[model samples]
Target: MTLPMQVPIPGLPARVRIHEVGPRDGLQNEKATVPTAVKADFVRRLAEAGLTTVEATSFVHPEWVPQLADAEELFPQVAALPVALPVLVPNERGLDRALALGARRVAVFASATESFAKANLNRTVDESLAMFAPVVARAKAAGVHVRGYLSMCFGDPWEGAVPVPRVVRVCRALLDLGCDELSLGDTIGVATPGHVTALLDELTGQGVPVDAVGVHFHDTYGQALANTLAALQRGVTTVDASAGGLGGCPFAKSATGNLATEDLVWMLRGLGVETGVDLDRLVATSVWMAAHLNRPSPSRTVRALSPTHHQEQ
Candidate 1:
């Protein structure tokens, strides 16, 4: 019901494409199983709210993430949506599952540190990359878009601050493996604006195009927006966010929820950056999801704008 005054910022991209991760990354770690139909509706609502790219679900084994076990059943439900629906694929098997469902876009998760590699993927950093190489290649061969998710780019709970060179090396490897783009992740939310700038600078210096990069920051330290601003200032136009701030790393205890889409949209709107999203519709969608999850929305913008906020007050 309220909007921030438009104030254009110099040196930022004119338009940003938000890669909404609510249905998949957001709900993947829920303690209880979210019904398949509900998940499908969530994706539809998000698309209706003008989110052009919504990650639908992951094809990881059910044992690894029971919350997304319905990927098979869920993908078909929302596959007809006009927006881009990307699915996460752990390996070739996961990619196979996604391909079977005619998924056009898929993502592979990688860790920048060995500790997280072992903790999350049960492999060394190289080993995990090796496992993903074939999957990326096949996805590319199938004419499907691929996104590589590099986690713990800023700080790792087990390894402490990750080196810029180390992150760059893994990023280059993912790009070499045929990934169309990479989402740099601050899984623990420990990144500051300076850290974000340094990483982007290093990546750009190492020949990683800024336009091919996306940022995925968590809110553990309340720095998601700041970190995102840094990325935007560096010319990155793709950002990963979840509705209602609904996900955390199941493998990394220190990790928290991904950056909130409503929060990001609010900031972008104020900055006069076009995201092609309807702020009112987006807030309402998050509020409806919060009701389904039986928890208040963690996004400040969602809470401030939702009609229920006044009712509760």
Candidate 2:
């Protein structure tokens, strides 16, 4: 009899919560518009496959992200799902739109690197935090849970190899601003295992609980899965991934998509960790989305497990 692949890493959680971001982060950067109905169906399928938290859409200006311009139409479709549907709000204006739409969970994105903040948000690092401060506070007062995303937590293409203290400072600020969870993002996929360990250790030293920290990684350097493993070993429970690796950063020039959910699920399952995700169903969802995007999924696991393959020119 053949044995199943099982590699147990020490001190890892028995289960992990995957925050699915394909419908939002993944689709925001697409060059083509994905219909709101298609986007809604995608989130519904993800929730049905056991992903509890799906980042539904961003309420940024339509000129900034024409792809997600239908946020108003999209939110109402998936808002009733039993899963947590968190939308990305760029500032207080975005928050107001979210509140009016009756969104119960939202996220505010910040950047650890000044270069990225200026390029992406047209503000300095401190200025962006100044922008998000009131948004997070008001959202909390309204009984909504906020997730804070710190981009370029490891390295920035403009500024190489970010220091741990810089990341910790921003993390502390976001927590102080009333964010219930922090998703530290390797926006350019420059983080390796050692960098991940040092940063997480310093977050502990700075009094941020491991449980309150999550990780978001891009596979620009193809290190997303490896970096996620390092985070998991350190007692980090929440992970951010897109179905079929369907994203790229418009600001971070060299960035690729976020880590694919299928790839992460495959590794987590092999390590004897439970994520409550149905792998086959997730893979099918990726394949379906790939057809709409007109490209083969960037996921290695999805490509390996897919029932159909389409050529990308």
Candidate 3:
């Protein structure tokens, strides 16, 4: 399939969609609980950087993720922003909390591997989907857009390698249940470019529209960028990234964080894909967020651009 416009970079399509998940996914795993004001400011800076879609926060129980305990308060403030802010809803209770905050878009998550599904959500694969059906239905009825996340799509730490057919089955179920988009996640960052290509080929061959699929890759072995390029080659426009490379999976031991948004944007721009994101602004946001966390940015682009770190003439 051809894109609406010709992309300037070789081997890249015309346009790409980036879903910035720094505030939600990135900050959630931080050792320190970021102040609500800081979180709001971090999101505002991302918006200023020209990001259209941002995952602001998750409405899961505080006990599960102490960092997002302030979701109710934070949602209203973020909801008033001018961009698309989506929150993660694990179940009907979380969905109710999101709806109470007047959220217009919410995302539901499920795992492709049975071990991860049962361990993470306390339910089997099919049982988890059954639990999500009511949440999807209610969100649709409320005129809210719902995105589905399928974790461990490429490889699972517990199960080792997940079958492509299993991933396709979950994708089909989510799409059938009225999810606007399905985000395929490499939860453990073990996906190679060839693995990505194979999965995309299989999913597309299975009749899943390329447009409805989003690729979320982790940067464990520094292969996230290459895998992202592979997805782009397959015409998957939507990509999920975290500013400053902020989050790591607790379930997957030794797993690295999500792909850095700044680095991802840089690569996309170099490939002639229009992302509408300002590199300098993103760099500034990452630096600011890193400072708040009292840690250096995990983003390579940010490190290279740091004023103090730049080589002197």
Candidate 4:
């Protein structure tokens, strides 16, 4: 396998935490149901590959996301892993399911645009926040860390160009509700580097600390890595990525897959920014997963570095 030459960039963090979301966010969008056993192995592989934080699965009702219906069966399979495993809990009921299974970290999905809130959660922005408040509080009370995922932070399909202040207001609300961190999402993947800088600056201006912010960009416009670089330039260290570029928004037709972890790691490696991820092992893991899913990996780095790349070419 080949690797990028390490070159440190000025004004970027010395290390970044890659929040791997392949097992949950990635697989949830798949048309085929990935078996529970495979999902467990995927999580284990990610941990073994040095991803500290891996989102395991969602506790949402199975009818809504039939792909993650095995959250109950799957969490236990990898719960003993040394890495942090965060699960998505939509409401108190979902929180209950996760808590019962000993999930130490959970995430609540929010939308920066009303149109997306209505489409994804079937609630207005305020209503969805109201729904998450108790859940966040309960999770915190139980000594669990909570993450708030704010979707459509950059652009929305129905309501184009989401205002920065609107996103800050919701960020404040989620933080006030006891969320430890917020993952700002470009749900439609329309964000450019300038747009990313503007949002991060506005969030800081509105009193949201940069350390509590994470960027989750989709590759719809092929700007995820550029947007991520911008976020890093602004001192945002946590990033959300999926192995093999595995996920997209189910409710948002314009959305593409999440930023590929392999690609992100490759970039960070070249930048001499430590992510603690073993590139070779990570690529192999994704290749193994691509085989399980019966599709080629969408990740550019994975395709370029995998053992079968020469044959595929």
Candidate 5:
């Protein structure tokens, strides 16, 4: 498919809100569990670097994600950090756990396809949405803001390309369920610029306010940055990213990390968009996290700026 050339949008907002998911979404798939102190410190550094919204941890079952087994302890430590720290709760049990730990914000997720929903949560789409109703109500009653996630919005690994209507349906359900905002995810990183534009256009046409939506893209095929630009042009002001470009879906086998926070900030700043994040500090944090994980960063900008062995000479 032929893609349109990206045209920079003029007169856009000077700053954008970046919801950092590194601590939770970013590390969930890692084989080694990050220490609680290390995780808490990572979050503190992120806040110190001007990240206001950070996903601190997931309150899912330890058996499902052993990496976050310390959620109970981790949440309390980070919750006192004086920032907007949200945790992902998969169901009522997770929500109850988060509430007991004094979580201020909670996120619930639903997949756009039957195959993905079953694979990721072992429930059908309707069933997942049904489970969120009481969770959202309980969260609202507790004076907590609830964020909804629609995974595999662009394509699913098992089912291939998903239809626009399906994505819209799931998004509408989440919004109707009283989520403060809904984040649409390119779960497998299969979205191109055209696909993103088309989806946003349809969603907007359906009367879903642009401000109520956020975009989450993966770099699996290297299209994440391009897709992000497309979303911005369409007036999406909120974005989901991970520090050091960490995270991928356990269900989407070949998926890569979420779009890197540094790369996104670099591009946004170049376009005169404000993300309220310090690029240099974020780069430093990414480097630290990558070292802790003992893996190379997936951020292109970070890799380019760092001196290689040849450069050191």
Candidate 6:
């Protein structure tokens, strides 16, 4: 696919790996119960669009996230896809459900701020980490790759610009759990470039391998792409992006869509960075999803490139 435009960005990697989260993170916020088949097709289309790591679904309790209640049925449909399907497991029960359906990769989420931990997970920071310790271990022992997600790593709504050390503590605990990687999240989309650098610096000082780190940014303040560039310059390889810029934290009422995969791919392509994603197909998938939900996608790249993006009313 041809790129929309190009602008030189210094100190960027030649290639970046985008961990597609639209299927889970993006759709969970939607009130509509997306059909199980639609979710499966979304993942499959993401793979066809050249996204290798599509987060397929979450194994959270149905009461908590009704959209993902079909995890049991969802996994079997996409289990054989030639891509990494990592499901979010809130605890051992979630892991059990994932494992039963042949899930080979899983993710555990924790909050850097105590307030968010209490609000989102109904547990304190330590309690959440303690719960994940054995889940990570047993999952690893079962040969499943585990990823740790530390939310509010940059700034928390209740706490305001979070302290690096506080975020680091959660990161260390996750690392201790033998997580294959850590996906630091800017849950409120308040992070700036400086915060991104400082956090990565501190994480490195604490002996956390930079290579084992990824970033998840929200576009609430329209800083997701700028912050993404900051992380990329700091050697972060994995980035979490939602197709058509879909989804936000249910807890963060003010937050917006994630850094759009289309926008990121557009910027990376301009910098001559290889993502291996078919931008045209990716936008098409997002467009199809938007139609299903009776809305236009929020992605700038999708809007700019779509032939019928803004149809005459």
The number of the candidate with the highest lDDT is 4
* RMSD vs true structure, all candidates: 1.2, 1.8, 4.0, 1.2, 4.2, 1.4
What is the C-alpha local distance difference test score of candidate 2?
0.91
Better TM-score candidate (1, 5): 1
Winner of 3 and 4 under TM-score: 4
State how far residue 15 of model 4 sits from its true place (Å): 0.2
Question: Candidate 6 residues 142-209, lDDT tens each?
Answer: 99999999999988778888999999988998998899999999998999999999999999999999
- Please report, in order, the local distance difference test score of every candidate based on alpha carbons: 0.93, 0.91, 0.89, 0.94, 0.88, 0.91
What's the residue-level lDDT of 238 in candidate 1?
99
Per-prediction TM-score: 0.98, 0.97, 0.95, 0.98, 0.94, 0.97
The count of residue-pair clashes in candidate 1 stands at 0
Candidate 3 lDDT? 0.89
lDDT of 2 at 146: 95
lDDT of 3 by residue, 179-208 (tens): 999999998899999999999999899999
User: Candidate 4 regions off by >4 Å?
Assistant: 307-313
TM-score of 6: 0.97
Tell me the lDDT of model 5 at 82: 72
lDDT score at residue 301, model 1, on the 0-100 scale: 85
Off by over 4 Å in 5: 1-8, 308-313
- C-alpha lDDT (0 to 100) for residue 56 of candidate 3: 97
lDDT of 3 at 239: 96
